[model samples]
Target: MTDTLKIALAQLNPTMGDIAGNLALLRKARAEAAARGADLVIASEMVITGYPTEDLVLKPMFLEAAESALQALALDTADGGPGMIVGGPWRQDPTARPPLYGKVYNTAYVLDGGKVTTHRTKHDLPNYGVFDEKRVFGAGPLPGPVNFRDVRLGVMVCEDMWKPDVSECLEESGAEILIVINGSPYELDKTEERIQLAVQRVNETSLPVIYVNQVGGQDELVFDGASFILNEDNGLACQLPAFEEALEVTEWYRGPAGWTCNPAHREAPAGGMEPIYGALMLGLRDYVNKNRFPGVIIGLSGGIDSALTAAVAVDALGPQRVHTVMMPSPYTSQESLDDAAEAAQLMGIGIDSVSIEPAMQAFNTMLQPILNGAAAETNAGDTTEENIQARSRGLTLMAISNKLGYMVLSTGNKSEVSVGYATLYGDMVGGFNVLKDLYKMMVFDLARWRNQVLPKGALGPAGRAIPERIITKPPSAELKPDQKDEDSLPPYAVLDDILKCLIEGEESVDAIVARGHDRELVNRVWRMLELAEYKRRQACPGVKITRRAFGKDRRYPITNAFRGPA
Candidate 1:
């Protein structure tokens, strides 16, 4: 009997729908595990087709392709080397009529000694907040344990481990150890939650648990891989680094008392802005590279938002790989231009200057007929003219993006996007918005943090990359004469707090008003948020850094008439 076993947890990043590429990665991971003397290797859930494959699983050809890839991988695991557990989509038999036999299951298969031995599917399917697993997969029944040499192992996929009944079932089936494969996306404090859950399960079942997770940025979601192992005694044995790919090997020995985990190796904690910063960088790099963009282009308005975005782009891709453009209109201040130029210089990136005077004039000339005589004056409404300037600038940036092969990075903060302060199809025209989920207050904090502690191996400007004037200045769109953001919206400090309550806390208008906020202010903000749903739906994808983002994480109907009482 195998008294001592080496298990490898492959925490890797897999691209969606890239079956061949994903298979290659799996093979490479398997080789690494084998080299490290691992007796068994485990990967994250849905490793073949990637997590949250959504509608791709509905296609028969896609399932066949995934199955073929899995078979090829199983063949590669021949020669009685290390056993492998891989995740993919599996279809049940088509004959049984009552329970819908042809249902799809999010499954994991264990391949050992040149053959497929056991399979298990996810039982609990999550359907809230960026997940539609129930729409795709059928709930799987409780699976039995798999015997490997002397030890009995139970496998759980993703959501299975979240519930206590599954672990209890595994314990009842006489399993000595439980292994969970997850494709859990990163949320702030999610790692702590995972550790607590693992400890709880270990204490309840009196069996050691190994949790393996996927790592990478898929569209708006970022997965932080922090695989861990807990002993039957409810003690943490080992933990891998977050936001990275690692092949962690743990040794288990059968003692006189029972099976116990050996003193496992651990990596140093990569905290203090490392995880969030790396997530942002990876999201940016993959979004640009995966979309086949040659590089990225950003409009560097002389504001903290654009400055940070520019820095992020330069860090994600090299400075040479980024292009900056400063499109200043008539209302744009000379100080802003100077700061923008200084930022470009500091970052060692070139910038092009395009004045929007010509385009603004053309727009005004064209709109004169529709506007009639009274509204066509030079001194029109401040917001109307300011929005026109912003639209003109957006058009110019988009043209440059089209002329040159580059993806545009929008620089709007969450505060602006939340309040409908941004112009639709104007400043919002971009392939990706870097800080769309970041509040204005958090934006300032992040800028300060970046300046203080430069990220690992960052190549951008070192000390205070953002100009002091940009950070200190009152934020303005510079669309009309002396137009400041405060003129329209509340101060960022007050605005962000209210937004946090309304969006993240889901506070009603009455609740917000009850929190010492003015009744009129709460109602106005709520109205703005409700009206902005349509614009947000049309907005581009952005990295999600907040608990609730405007993208897939928060889905509100655009055509709803359920306004609160006035």
Candidate 2:
């Protein structure tokens, strides 16, 4: 038996639908590992087809392409002599009986010396929030262990490592080490949770675990690649960096006690708000770059929301790629205009001032004929006026987008998105919404945090990227005179708390109301959220920082009659 085995963890950022590109990356990693005399190279879950391909995996041609890619990968690794554990979609008999032969599996294939030997299917298929694996992939019945270089290794996919049953089965089958390939997405403190789980698994089975995770932004989801290896004694052996792609090579030597990993070189920790900030930056950068968008343009109102959005845009793409348009309406404040110009100048981004008064007047004048008999003093006219202003701004932004080939970014926060305070076709009109899932309170906190911990090459103002008045003053849509967000809705502190309970905690209305909230307010908020489902459904894609973001993660019916406590 070999006393030591060298293992390579390939933490790669894969682009979805790029089968050939993904395969090339896999082969490159394999070649590098082989050059280093490593025994095996382990990749992340679904590395070939990319993670969360969603319904794309169900397509026959897609599956065929994936299968072909897998064959090519196997052939590439044939002469390398180093084994590889790669994750991809596999076909089952589509026309089988009760057990269903055609059911596809979220599987990992073990290839060595040009031959595919072992295959393991994921056991615990997570169906909750952002995971629909149960609906797509079939569970595997076998819990067999694979033996390579006299080492009995247990391999499991992402969720399989989270469960005890699968780990126990592998341990019982005489597995020496547990290698888990994951496609885990990033949330606030998900890295800590993953560490705890890995430690718990090691304590349970007395086996060291090596976790390799995919890293990249996929639409709303961002996978932070902070892969690690933990010893059976529940000690941290090695940890890779977060929010970046890295190839980690570590050696495991057999000792009198058992296999002990050589002390892993740890990268600098992205502590506190760094990971979150890095996640947003990477998510935004990838979303723009991957989609082939030339540049991004945001409507800057000098408010904290737009100010923060502008800062993030400039950080994600350089100042040259970020353009700001200040669309002042009748209710626009002079202070707001000054702040907008200041922020644009500080960031060195292009700024254009376009007054909406002309467009707003034209819209009202055109509608005057149809509304000749309508009451001018009614609140309906006020509402129409506000909507027309919003729509006019949307039209102007869309025109700039069409002319300059820039993608408009919607600047609505979760507080407004949650309670339907945002105009669907107005402020919500954009190719992407950066702060859709960030609460208003969080927006303020993040702005402060950004000011304190500015990015390395930030061009924006050094301190307080957002104006102090904007953060201190009550939020307003600036649609009408004396319009404050508090006048139409609850305070952000209370609103965000209630929303966290309802949206993230999934607490019922009565449950939320029982938490010292007014029943009427809870009911109103719930109704607004329900009614705004259609709008959210049609809203632009944004990064999902929260656990229960209103994207693919939180799928709800638009026409549902379901209501919370009356």
Candidate 3:
């Protein structure tokens, strides 16, 4: 065996369903590694098909196209560049018995000298939390090590590294180094967990490890590609940055003990709102770009939720790609109007004024009987009028979305979404929501954070995208005169904490109340949260920054009846 070996870790962004574009990215990384004299260029899992292909794996034509792309990549290795390791769906053995026939496995191809030298399928098909691998692809066999020129390398796919048995079997089967390819998505503290998991494996097998992950947004998911290398002693050797594509060659030297990776610069992972902001940007960017939406249209109210959503939209897609509309009612405060205009100017996004008063009057004329007979109201009218105005705004936004190709961006925060504080066809109408999982308190925090610094990939001006007045002002729906959010809900500070414990921490009402909260309020918030399950179930998909988001991470049935303690 050679004393020295070089492996290129390609942490990259992949567009879902673009087989050709994905292959081009892989080839480009391959050329870069070849230029650096690396022996093998390793890419993330399902690099050719993007990730979480969902039900697309069930299509026959897509699988054929993906296989064709893989073949093309293998043939390209004929030019004598560094060999390629690419991930995609490969059909199971045709000679196998009935049920297994025509099945596809989440397979990785090892290509060199114009041929696929070897292929290994992923053993642990992850089925939980944003993964539905078991539904689409069949499980692969326990993988053994592959013989490279000098090293017997144990190759594992994304979920394979998460479990212990796979790595144990690989070590016992004569694998030298553990090289894992991943399409791991980003969560609050996942990067740290990944490192510790890798460390655990290294301690068990007495072998070095290299982890390469895919970066970029895929629908509701964002993959933070902070790949790393760890020595046999569980020491971190090399680290890559998160939320972006990176290609780095790691030098390994085999000795009497084992392979020790040469130390490289370890970038501190992004902290505080930086990582959260990055996840939002990448998630929105990929969702817009990959889905081929012309741009995004946001109903820019003077409220914090709308302001932050607009800011994220501008950061994700340039100002030119984000269009804003201000649908104002009679109750729309002058302060809100001025704040919305100021935000538009600061962010350099165009804003149009669309009055919802006419539609509101029309709705009132139609619903007069119900309002007169069955509603209690002040001089301004009742909740029926409020809902009409909201629904009118929703109609105007949807019309704009249909006229132009811009997707509507919803601005409801998790606090409001959790308690059903939003109108169904009104403020909740949007193709996607950038902050569906963020609590109201977190929204203010991120907005403040954005104003303080020009985050990377921000398309707006350097100053504040969220105006000071907007941030400082009391939040309201402005449906009725002098209406405030606090009229219906508790302060965001109290509400968000209760939500974090109940939704994320899954704590009981008594447990949350033990932290000095009103038992009555805790029970009330829990009821609202439980009752709003249907709304959340129908809400547009959003980026997840917290540990347990409202989407896949936290799945409560709309028909759920269980409630916390009184």
List per-prediction Cα lDDT, in the order shown. 0.84, 0.84, 0.88
Q: Estimate each model's TM-score.
A: 0.95, 0.93, 0.95
lDDT of 2 by residue, 1-566 (tens): 78998999999988888888899999889888888888889999999999888777777777888888888777766685688999998877643333322277888888887777778888888989888887777788747688876888899999998878889999999998899999999998899899999988998999899999999888888898999999888878788988778887789998886787898867656777677767777788778887889989899998888988888888878888998999998788888888888777766777899999888767766777788834243223567788877888898999999999889999999889988888879989998888887999889988878877777445444665666676676778888876888998999899998889989998987788788999888878888888888988889988889898998779889999988433
Q: Could you give me the TM-score of model 1 versus the true structure?
A: 0.95
Report the poorest 10 consecutive residues by lDDT, candidate 1.
93-102
lDDT of 2 at 408: 94
Q: For residues 236-300, what per-residue lDDT tens digits would candidate 1 score against the true structure?
A: 78888877788887889977655777877676556656666767777787788767899989888
What tens digits encode model 3's per-residue C-alpha lDDT throughout 223-324? 999999999988888899998888998888888897789997578887889999999999998888888999999999989999999999998889999999
For candidate 3, the per-residue lDDT at 328 reads 92
Best by lDDT: 3
Name the Cα RMSD for model 3.
Answer: 2.2
Number of clashes recorded per candidate: 0, 4, 0
Give the poorly placed runs of model 2, Cα more than 4 Å off: 93-102, 268-271, 373-380, 456-464, 508-510
